[model samples]
Target: MTYTTRADFMSGLREALGRNNIPDARDILIDFDQHFDGGAAAGESEADVCAKLGDVDEIVKQYISETDGRFTEAQKETPVQETVITDNEPEKNMNTGDFAQTAKEASAPEIKNERSGPSAGGIVGVIFMDIFLFSWTLITLLSLIISLYAVTIAFAASGIAIFVGAIMIAAVGAAGFISTGFAPISLIFCGIMMCAFGGMLVIASIAATRGFINLIIAVINLNARRFTGHNVCRKIGRKYREERD
Candidate 1:
């Protein structure tokens, strides 16, 4: 069945795995949990993440095939009956050899899926990405973030200055040192308003900074995957989300 939410997807997967007697179900669940978390941190919706993950039934079937085959092989290697123990030691050795061979065969596909050498076109793309696209994009994002922070600081400084100046004016007016044009009470109110506005700006700037950082990291990961065939984006996303949380 279609699952739009992480909770539904995970629950369905867990149930399916249990029905199929899949081993290491906990590990499987944890992996999917991280996958959802990573997608969330990358500004993807739960539905989008689930769509990328594909069907729950298919995932369960995959786990069952991989895990159940190993379990069956393990059972076959074990001497369940007394008569089986009477077999020659060489037969036992052969059974162990067969199990090892089966394991190697099972893992072969995973080895093939790892990043391989890039082709000529891939090499050219990587060079272009590194030299122009990536460099300029990173610089622009950093500049934006820095500018936002500078504005935030400027607001905070302005607010503090106004607050302090208002206090000084009130003290001076009470002492009758000089005839200030504006009312001391009005100046104090304006100062408080500036400080409040600055505080709000500080919050907005922090959120903008985080968003820009996430965008920069996403762009880098996209290029890395496109050129190098290294799928580390999800891992980085998970790490970023974890740190933020």
Candidate 2:
């Protein structure tokens, strides 16, 4: 192609490269413009030059399409944009490439909890979860043992209270007017205390069950071939060799 035709083609090629920048375009341009003065030396007419070079768009496409199994930087780095629609609102949107770069960035999460979603039952739930997760097994194992000792003492004391209260009720005929009926009130209060203690006991039992289950699961994972990337053959051989030694 003539100098003018080659110049026009190269200008467009440069713009396309800026956006899609495939190496194939660079290679094609290299082969197509083998002239010493960069395709100008050919001195062919503009129309004839373009005709020989063929369709510029089709040539660019063909170059990009010749990818072998091996991946270049551009090919390997091409963004795979995936769309995710959660129940939460979409606060930000960008190309997949840019989003991934931001994810790997060494910074704290920009979205704060308050802005992310609605709050829970706040302090009440927090207290219950703390009781369920952190107490008994984690923070108060010894306290729980002490509480067991206290349970034995309380049971013996309450049984005596029950027997004495019954006898008093029969003798004094004053079950209805014992300390202006505060005896029943106090007993009701004791019942509530016992219920709270029972709830705590239940939580402790659940936490212990979960902890032992987790331990079992950990042991199972260690023995499994997939978790440690050891095959059954390797395990059998190791056992056999251990027995021999």
Cα lDDT of model 1 by residue, 32-137, tens digit: 8778879999999999999999998999877756665776644444322211221112122222222222222222223224324445765676567668766776
Off by over 4 Å in 2: 1-4, 24-27, 35-43, 68-70, 74-245
lDDT of 1: 0.59
How accurate locally is residue 71 in candidate 2, as Cα lDDT from 0 to 100? 46
- Which 10 residues in a row give candidate 2 its minimum summed lDDT? 86-95
Q: What's the residue-level lDDT of 115 in candidate 1? A: 26
Q: TM-score for all predictions?
A: 0.45, 0.25
lDDT of 2: 0.41
Worst lDDT run of 10 residues, candidate 1, spans: 82-91
lDDT of model 2 at position 56: 62
- Whose TM-score is greatest here? 1
